[model samples]
Target chain A: MPFVNIRITNEGATTEQKQRLIKGVTDLLADVLGKNPKTTFVIIDEVDTDNWGIGGESVTEIRKK
Target chain B: MPFVNIRITNEGATTEQKQRLIKGVTDLLADVLGKNPKTTFVIIDEVDTDNWGIGGESVTEIRKK
Candidate 1:
């Protein structure tokens, strides 16, 4: 079984988009690594910008520039 | 640095609870794996029951039993 996680800034993505990501990642692993889609788990996390940090600065602060 | 993700069914977890999970996971990794808490990423995913599946059935469906 393979578990894949996709973390993205909570920017108002529609449900369809999340489903596509799940499908895409699952298909990719199945194609490249011979993984079974049935046993694969895809989780999408929509993190708040304030909760996501890069270079010691949160994404919320970085976006103010 | 370690990226740890915890997925749980969306069942009305408070903000404090989520923060506690983050802290608990970070400390656990630091204690057990010698990982740096500063750079450790703890992501908590609250998945909708309809989106979470098990044995070809979604959690929502399974909970009906």
Candidate 2:
């Protein structure tokens, strides 16, 4: 079984967009590694701007400056 | 900053259990890798039995047999 986890900044992705991501990732894994889509698990997590940081500064603070 | 994703079979984990997982992972990353807890992100994904498999058989099917 292949488990795929995707993390994105909380930018409010539409349901359709999330659906596309799930399907695309599953298809890619199946095509490349011959993994069964039925057994593939894809999960998406949206991180809050204040909670996600890069270069020691939160995304929320970076956006403010 | 560390981003940790945990995947487990969906067997109805309690809210407190998930909270402990998040806290424990964050602490471990900080202790082992010196990652900042403020910037650490821990997300848990519960996979459905029908979508998780091993050896070409789904967990759902395995459970049945």
Candidate 3:
């Protein structure tokens, strides 16, 4: 089965929201990847804002500005 | 950042080997993907033997006589 993993800064999400996101993504992968729901594996990492960036902008910098 | 994920039937590995595997792959991702070692996240799924197959051979069937 294809594996799916996601990493995002924990900047804008509450704990409940993060848990829901994990569940949703894991369910989606099980359906899309043709794997059993129990067999599907998803890992999400909540990173620090300073450690993540896009388009040359650190997450902390973008959030601040 | 590019994400990396791997899933394998844990038919052939000991517990220690699996731990080493996670570490090895995570370190490799840091070097190859240019992410911080602490920031890189990895997930491994050990699937049931009957639930996984390759080249039309179920893992358990192949392992069996």
Global lDDT of each candidate: 0.79, 0.78, 0.59
- DockQ for every prediction shown: 0.14, 0.09, 0.12
Per-residue C-alpha lDDT of model 3 across residues B6-38, encoded as one tens digit per residue: 576655546665566456545544443344666
lDDT of 2 by residue, B1-65 (tens): 88887888898999999999999999998899898999999888887555444443445656888
Q: What share of the true interface contacts does each candidate keep?
A: 0.02, 0.04, 0.19
Cα displacement (Å) at residue B41, model 3: 15
Please provide TM-scores, in order, for all candidate models, with all chains considered together.
0.58, 0.54, 0.46
Using TM-score as the measure, what is the rank order of every candidate, best first?
A: 1, 2, 3
Instruction: Report iRMS values in order.
Output: 4.0, 6.7, 10.4
Instruction: Name the 10 consecutive residues with the lowest summed lDDT in model 3 chain A.
Output: A26-35
Total clashing pairs in model 2? 0
DockQ of 2: 0.09
Q: Regarding TM-score, does 1 or 3 come out ahead? A: 1
lDDT of 1 by residue, B9-42 (tens): 9989999999999999999999999999999998
Top-down DockQ ranking: 1, 3, 2
Residue A46 of model 2, lDDT score: 74
